[model samples]
Target chain A: MSRQALAELFSRCRAENRAALLPYMTAGLPDPEGSVRLFVAMAEAGADGFEVGIPYADPLMDGPVIQAAGDRALAAGSGVEVALDILEQVVAETGRPSVVMTYVNPVLRMGPEVFAQRLSQAGASGAIIADLPVDEALPFASALDRHGMGLVLFVAPTTTEARLENVVQASPPFVYGVAELGVTGERDMASSHIGSLVARVRKHSEVPVVAGVGIATPDQARSAAAAADGVIVGSALVRRVMEADTVDAAEDALRVAVGELADAIRRD
Target chain B: MRLDRPDNQGRFAEYGGQFAPETLMPALEELETEFAKAWDDPGFHNELNKLLADFVGRPTPVYRAERLSDQLGIDLYLKREDLAHTGAHKINNTMGQALLTKRMGKNRVIAETGAGQHGVATATACALLGQECVVYMGEKDIERQALNVQRMRMLGTEVRPVTSGAGTLKDAVSAAMRDWVATVDTTHYIIGSVVGPHPFPWMVRELQKVIGEELQEQMDGSQRPHPDVIVACVGGGSNAMGIFYPYVGSDVRLVGVEAAGYGLETGEHGASLVAGSPGVIHGSMTYLLQDVQGQILEAHSISAGLDYPGVGPEHAYFKDRQLVEYTSITDEEAVEAVNLLASVEGIIPALETAHALAWIAKEADSLRGQTVALNLSGRGDKDVQQIIDLVDADE
Candidate 1:
């Protein structure tokens, strides 16, 4: 059911001849109440779907912006349960298919089956474990599948073609293709290597490929959108939310960034 | 005893596995393949043995601590890893890994340090081999281990200070792993302990098992060549694993001592084996100090080397199997043990090593007349300033 919902969203975007604009926000970040408000506002501002980040202590793959935001969410008493609660609300209230993004440790600690069951119960579409390798995706993938939710896998520019075939074989709702070599952060432009990575991913599976990391500006997002099926905007919007002094102002700034990114991916 | 470990997927009976990011998977796989080939290659062993003898001054002596043994009423033998180059058993693994780095055609190595012994050792090996060396240390550790920082710089290493998460070993590990993710092609992350993902725990243990092999050979003619008890300090559990691996199926008792900062009751300690729950940290599923919500809590210890929040996953497996018994020693007691060993045996032990000595001191009455081999893991020359401050406070 959840996989179908995500697939329909992707199909709808393809029919419209635009890449899906998936805006990411750390769940319960800054504060639980404010984060929910921001998620709702971004949804209204034309975000095609939501990628709600479940804050973890050691976010090795995150840059300063997302890490700081995650720290704030954790400090504000947002544990795994709270993050799931917020994820449920974002999907329910915004009426958009939402995916929970987190490191693998939390899921492992929570018991993968239980965690998957909770996500399914929470109305989440799927999950993207940033640190879980495709080879080690068995128990996790099987558990999520039992709940009719997808486990998204990653394909990096550094990924070898042989490994790319293995990753695509897992059959995720989409492949998360990293745009650059480093962690998640905004850059002035996307790496040209992403186009080749997406093309390589296409050779193995028919799954939609979404490129993320280092995409900040709308032009960068537009370029990333051209290479893949969709583009994920995270750090750029997260930084705007963090830099704003007031919660209201943070919400406004996030909505504006989402609007421009959504517009960038849209076909004229 | 024929010990079967780390099944096909690197799981040490559901404990150890490669629990890292997607990007690092290929590198880890490559490392595993290379390590397996190197282990089977006699030429690789010959080169590593030559380095161990010439560069690291291996075959480290086991001294009978007569005075301390008499005082404690036990036949105590000290495996003097302190005598090794870079002042610890850490050099053993570093030398082996550095050679592997060369074999892999990687010219740069990245490492993380807490007390800086591993950093110094890694820097030394990289210098000898002409490889670029970068060491990541937590900012707080940089303040405490300043002298080692200078030593590292003098030896042509770049010490990058990490200011994240409690500013300690766990954070340094996180930073090093992040660096590896970005530079996996040109750099090999020389993890400083028997921790992290699959091949690391297995590779480091195999590299360090030389300590046990030597001790067994040295005691070949002794009445009690097989000791009744083998004790060592556990920080990511490298030294303990090294010393304990050879005697696994024997009648020998393996004991690991963790640091209890104030007391176990006070909840400010690095005694993960004693008080921690099972969780994943720094790549492997292990015992770690984590809250109910799975956020890793900061572990505190006066000894910087033992102040990490997690223990190696293999140690966790042993603890669960009743193969090894783990306990804790407080800071005050460990400090006294340091002073006692220095005065009685004329040997200053690293604070991390002192914890093992401290445990023997407490258990002397019950362990009377039994042969106890304690791993004196490192020398305390680098711990002079920290010891001075403690002594000053005492006076």
Candidate 2:
């Protein structure tokens, strides 16, 4: 059911002639209620899909903003179950396709089979696990597939053309193309390297390839959407929530920001 | 044992693999290919062996500690790795990896350090090989190992202090991994211990096998050729694996001593193999000191080098297969062992090595009739200040 939901989401994006507006949300960022509240606002403001981050203890790939958000989430006593609960609540409210983003350790600790089962039960369309390269990702991918959830894989700027097939062969819902060379953070338009990486990924896979890691503003999102099927904005959205004074302020800020991104990604 | 492990997928019975970001997957592949080519090449071996012998001072003797032996009523043989260049067994791996960095055509080297011995050795090797070197150390480790920090700086290497997640060895490893994720194209991360992603645990162990290999050659002339037992400290288990890998299936019993900081009950120790459960850390699945939610716990020890939450994957394999007996010693006991070795033989052992000596000292009476070989992995000159403070506190 969840895998079908994800496929339907991509179909919807194509029919609407707009790139998927997948806004990354860190679950339980100051608190669980606030995280859900903000996601509800993002969904209302035209977020086509959601990437829900389950805060981890050590987020090596994440920059300072997402790292701080995760740190606060963990400090508030949120674990895998709590994050899954948040996912359930978001899906219930939004009724939109959403994927859980996590580092591999938490899923491994939860036991991959049980982890996949729980996420599927929580109504997660798929999962994006950071730090799990395709070399060691087969078992986890199979586990998710067995549970009827899409497994998202990454194709970084550093990934060469020769190595593109193995990742594409996995047939992820979307190939997460890391636009930048460094950890996840905001970057300027001075370096727009997403197109080349997206082009390389498209050579092997027909599925929509979404560029992430370096994108921030609506302008960057539109420019990135021009090169790829979609864009995943993480640190930029996270910084807004982290720097906000109250829940209302954060929700309003996210609603406006996601709305701008959605407008910018509209191809027609 | 036959000792062919990590398989092709880099797993040692479900432990160890490329648990890194996609950015470094190609880099790991490149490294594995280059490392295999270098391993099979005689020219690579010729250069590395020459550097090991002349630059890093290899083939350090196995000195029989007569006085300590008399006290223990056992023939105690110390593999004097303290005599090696840079005052620890770390130089062996550093020289080999530095050469690999050159062989791979990467001119930059990045590493993480705890006691800073590996940092100093890496800096020295990079200086010799004309490779730019950078070392990530925990903020707390930088404070404790001040002398080693200065030594790294003096060797013309940049020592970056990591402040995240308890500011210790585990954090330093994460910081270095993050750096490698960004700059992997021109940079070859020289992981200090046998604890990182695949090829590392295998590569480091292969490079360091000289310790056990030399012991095999040196003890051949003795009446009891192979010692009844071999002991080495297990901070990430490089030194222990170095000496133990050769004797995996041999009659010689292998024991790895870990640092049990305040004690197991206090929940403050670096005894990952002894007290930890299996989890992923620093790009490899291994025994880790992590909470139920897989959040890494802060590991404590007076010895900065041993203050880590994860052990090498091979050590985890040995633990599961019952190939080696893993034990722990408290900081107080390790300090006493340091004083004991300095007083008995006038040899100051590093706090990391003292953990092994402390274990051997405690078990000496039980193994009275046998020969025990302990890898004295490092000297204590770098730890003199902390020792003085500890002794003064005792007085």
Candidate 3:
């Protein structure tokens, strides 16, 4: 049911001939309740969907912006339960397809079936487990499948054609294309290699491919969006929320920041 | 190879799978292929063995601890890895990996260090091999292990201090992973222990298996051959794995000692094998010190090298299969063993090595009349300052 909602949103974006603007936020950032408000504001600001990050002590894939946010959220007692609460609220209030981004350990710690059941219960569309590659995702993907949820897999420019075919065969909710060879952070421009990687993904399946990592500015988002079906702007937006002194300040900034990104990727 | 691999996907009986990000999967696969090819190649063997002999001082003597052994009514033999070029067993792995890096056509090297022994060894290899090298060390370790830190820098390597998450070994591992993700094209991360994602645990053990191979050759023909038990300290467990690999299926007992810090009771210990549950850390499934919510807890030890929250996945496999015995030694006991070794044997040992000695001392009663071999993984010079500070505190 949750994956169906995300599929419909993707179809709508495709019909409009525009890339969907999917913004990411670390759950329980300032606090649990405040993060729900932040997601609500982002949805109101025209984000097509949300990717809520679960706080983990060790985020090897994240840069400073998201790392600091995760550390703060964890310190604020944002464990899986708290993040799920925030995910449930964001999905209920925003009425958009949302997912959780986490490392592999927490899911394994909770046991995949239980974790997936709780994620679905929280109204999540799917999950993007950063360290969980397709090769080691059998149990997790099957567990998520039982809950009618999708497992999103990543494809980097470094990924070979044969491996990309294998990833597409997993039939993820959507394919996450890593924009560059680095952790999640803002870059001056969209990575040049993303276009080829998106093209590779397009050849295998009709599944929507989203470009993420280091996409900060409107033009960068537009370029990344051009290469794929959607663009995921995380660190750029996360940096705003991180630097804001108050939730009110962050909400207003996100409204404007997400608006510019939406406008840049939106078709008439 | 006496040390078996973790299947095709790198899972060693539910432990030691490649749980890294998607980007690193190809690199891991590539490394696995390269490592196998290198291992099979006679040229690679000749070069590695030659360097092991000429530069790093191969076949470090296995000396009998006559005085200490007589005190306990047991024969204690020490595999003096301390006598190696870098003053630790770490060189055995680094020299091999640095050469492997060159063969892979990667000119840059990155590594993470705990007590700085691995960093010094890695840096020395990169310097000798003419590769650009960088090492991430915990800020806490850099403070505690100042001398080895200086040696690493003097070897012309960049020493980056990781201040995140207690600024210890695990955090340093995370920092090194972050760097490798971006620089993987031209660089190779020389993980310092039998940890991390696959090819690493298997490959490091293979490189270090030389210790066991040498021991078998030296002792198998002698009258005083076939020890009743073998003991070594385990952090990420390379040194222990090194000396324990050959005698795995034999009747001889294999024991790995961990640091108990203040004591397991105080919850300030690094005894992951005994105290931790199965979980993933540094990209592989292993026994880890974590809260129920899955947040990693800080591991404490007087020895900087053993101050880690996780043990090697291979060690986890061994523990589960009952192929080896896992034990712990407290900080107080380790200190006492250090004093005992210095007084009785005139051989100052690394704090990491003291854990194994302390275990022997504790089990002296049971081990009486039995012959035991312990891998003295490193010398005490790097830890002498810390020991001196402790003595001064007592004074």
Which candidate leads the pack in DockQ?
A: 3
The Cα local distance difference test for each model comes to 0.89, 0.88, 0.91
Please identify which of the two predictions, 2 or 3, would achieve the higher DockQ against the true structure: 3
- lDDT by residue for model 2 over B342-376, one digit each (tens)? 99999999999999999998988898978899999
Better of 2 and 3 by lDDT: 3
Give the DockQ-based CAPRI class for model 3.
Answer: high
Question: Which pairs clash in model 3?
Answer: none
Model 3: lDDT of residue A109: 85
lDDT digits (tens) for residues A165-249 of candidate 3: 9999999999999998979998876689778988888888888899888889999988877768889999888889888999999
Listed in order, each prediction's TM-score against the native is 0.98, 0.97, 0.98
Q: How large a fraction of the reference contact set does each model reproduce?
A: 0.46, 0.75, 0.70
| Model 2 lDDT per residue over A35-100, tens place | 889989999999877899998878888887887888888898787888999999999899988899
Which window of ten consecutive residues has the lowest lDDT sum in model 1 chain A? A186-195
Candidate with maximal lDDT: 3
